[model samples]
Target: MNKIFLFISFALISITTQAQEIKWMSFNEAVKAQKKNKKPIFIDVYTAWCGPCKILDKKTFSNPETAKFINDNYNAVKFDAEGNEEIVFNKMTYKNPGYKPERKNSRNAMHEFTGFLKIQGYPSMVVINNKGQIQKTIVGFKTSEELKKEL
Candidate 1:
């Protein structure tokens, strides 16, 4: 009985520890949510080949306080800088017709939205207001504390 109790305790502890997560949505969903709630949008633009992007995902975005703050305050979106996903924002349909699967890990063509935003580098963080206007852009990796200030 004692062994079973210990196992259940450990399982509960693991579940609680894993609950801290950033709720990332698609850009379209974020736009719809913004229309209803008037919350700002936070976009994390990253390519798969960027090392600093991975670090930001693992360290800053995964932090409990950071996740909770973003979840509560902003409509978060994770955008692949080189991906082929279609995004419609501000009466524009953004697509990457030249995206090649072979160049998934290497330097591929940028998504139309990325180009539209004039993102010069990977790991760019964009803050957009509820009115669909760009607020600020932070290029490169930032710690959780730094991101909190941006929030």
Candidate 2:
């Protein structure tokens, strides 16, 4: 009976932990959620070939604490800096049809958010208010605690 109770407890704990985290959103979905909820947008801009970007996704962003805070306070957006996803920003549609895939990155660029966000480094993040004003810009991989404070 004790073993059965412990097993049930562990299962419940796993489910509860998963429930605390938010599912990541695409850029457009994040933007729309911001409009509807009047919350800030937390955008994660990364390049597929950037090692630090992979670290951010695998280590930093995957933390349950970060996920919970981001879901609660902001609309989380994830974007690839060198992806072929066509996106419209600030009334202009940005594209980069000639961007070649670099190293082992999965695809090429078809967007100009790289320059628009002034991304000088990999694994950059930007926080924007509901009015489309930038609140903060963070570069590099950040721990869950650090990002939670920002949110």
Candidate 3:
């Protein structure tokens, strides 16, 4: 009976921890969720070849405390700045015109959405209000504590 009780307790703890994780969504999904929850959107714009972007993902975003805070407050989005995906935001369609298979791993031309946001560097973090307007843009890498403060 004690063993069974311990197992059940462990299972519940695992579920609770997973629930606190940041649920990363696409830009469109985040926008859709915003309509229902009325929460701001957090976008992390990165490229495949960026070193700081990897650090941000591994060190900052991996922190449970930071993830929980973002999960509770904002709809998170991971945007590939040079990706060839089609994104529709604010009644406009954004695409990558110069995307090629040869440059898929390296830096290709910027996507229309990246230009629309005026992102000048890799690992740019953007905050969009619930009203679908951009609130702020912070470029470069930040620690978990720094990112929490930004949020």
Highest-TM-score candidate:
3
User: What would the per-residue lDDT of candidate 1 be over residues 1-151, giving only the tens digit for each residue?
Assistant: 9999999999999876766788899988999999999999999999989999999999999999998899898999999989988999989999998899899888888899998888999799998998788999999899999988866
Native-referenced Cα lDDT, model 1: 0.91
TM-score of each: 0.89, 0.79, 0.89
Model 3 scores a TM of: 0.89
Better structure of 2 and 3 per lDDT: 3
The C-alpha local distance difference test score for the whole of candidate 2 amounts to 0.76
Report the C-alpha lDDT of model 2 over 1-151, residue by residue, as the tens digit: 9999999999999998887666668877777777789988888888776787887777777787777777888888887787766667668776667676563266555358667777777788998888877888888777777767655
Q: TM-score for model 2?
A: 0.79
Q: What is the lDDT of residue 149 in candidate 3?
A: 77
- 10 residues in a row with least lDDT, candidate 1: 14-23
How do these models rank on TM-score, best leading?
Answer: 3, 1, 2
Angstrom error of the Cα, residue 44, model 3: value is: 0.6
